[model samples]
Target: MKNTKAMRHSGPSAELEAKGLHRLAGERVLLDNISLSVHGGDRIAIVGPTGSGKSLLLRSLAMLDPIDAGEVQWRGESVHGRDIPRFRSQVIYLQQRPALVEGTVEENLRQPYFLRAHRDKHFDRERVSRLLSSLGRGDSFLSQHQRDLSGGESQLTALLRAVQLDPAILLLDEPTAALDSDSTAMVERLVIDWLSEMPSDRATVWVTHDDEQSRRISNAMLQIHDGKLSKDVHERIR
Candidate 1:
């Protein structure tokens, strides 16, 4: 299936973008010809009811899911094949429930560096400790075993792992859903601080059900309903 509208390529290219994206489960549409552009410094919040295809959209943008129709581009070029690993490294996706290795928090954090995509990068203890400090965690937090961590702590560890990799774009799927207010604030601060460190080179797209969080984290908000974006937000984003 093809989108009726032409794919957009004109104007300044976005750091990440979807052009005429579509996904289907049999005959039912899971995503409806979605097109969006995310530039550096963008903090986008996607808000919607359950089953609105919000997670599907984020996964598609990360290229973690196959699309029935459309293309994803990074820096104006179509991403494919050998380029996917690099693309995934730069655009990291964090699901609602983070998966951690069966080891200490520090071990989990160090795991990504073992990947070929991040072979040139080493785990930075000092930087991670500083970030832990910002979250009110002592250096010993790293020594705690993953099995002993609470939901909030696991989420923090997961966030720390991703941030330490220094990804250019973060696709957050309700990262703070399981946290209390204080922990949520810490997550927000950590993300804001990371983006501030590279304002013109980093961006995030957060899928959240909390209206307050959407207002707090995003400069732009898009609403999805029944697998389609609201008309107003769709026009603005396109």
Candidate 2:
């Protein structure tokens, strides 16, 4: 069955929109007139060749980098100043390499709460454990030291850190690119579970070069080339 909310004709207003987003590096156009609209419950996969501005587009949407022109809107409104921090909290951008501190996995997951943006939110160990278990991890996973974890473990920890906060939007940039096949499937399962938890309230924008992975994870596929986005590539599942 199709998610009627994500259909082209009807749904809630866009949760995130990039209007004519442009990023230039001197004479080169990194992101050219990039426009995108992400509704709630959207699982969008962006694919492109290397150095084709895939990462740039994601970072631009995350508001991590300044756009030469265009605006990023959250909930139909432009974000600025204090709103940026709040926006970032709700719209997390996870990179391929997650930075872990010298501590246990649980501690790293709990660290976000210490930030002013997430002060009101407390870490839910139970929820985190459940997420870990979904990926075949046990309670011992959380107690393990960060340095002792493998590449997949580190990425899982990073994903948990973001997902635990209940972000409305997730911007994943090749999150499982470095892991083995088993780990990749684990990461994929975790994301699938996360989406199912709040089918109508959450969304993810994943960047990956793997065509097979893109089809498996996204209801819609977006192709980016030469700093432009093409919507005609893959029709939304109906």
Query: Considering every candidate listed, which one attains the maximal TM-score?
Result: 2
Question: RMSDs, each prediction?
Answer: 3.5, 3.3
Pairs clashing within candidate 1 = none
The digit string of per-residue lDDT tens for model 1 on 125-177 reads 99999888877789999999999998888888899999999999999999998
What tens-digit string does per-residue lDDT give for candidate 2 at 1-238? 0122223622458888888889999999999888787877788889999988989989988999998998999988998777999999999999989889889998999999999999999999888878887777789988999999999989988988998998999999999989999989988898889889998888889999998998899888778888877547746753
Model 1, position 24, has a per-residue lDDT of 96
Per-model C-alpha lDDT, please? 0.86, 0.86
Q: Which 10-residue window in model 2 sums to the lowest lDDT?
A: 1-10
Candidate 1 regions with alpha-carbon error over 4 angstroms: 1-12, 234-238
Cα deviation of 139 in candidate 2 (Å)?
0.7
Tell me the deviation in Å of residue 181 in model 1.
1.8
Worst ten in a row by lDDT for model 1 = 1-10
User: If scored against the real structure, what TM-score would every candidate get?
Assistant: 0.92, 0.94
Q: After superposition, how far is residue 36 of candidate 1 from its true place, in Å?
A: 0.4
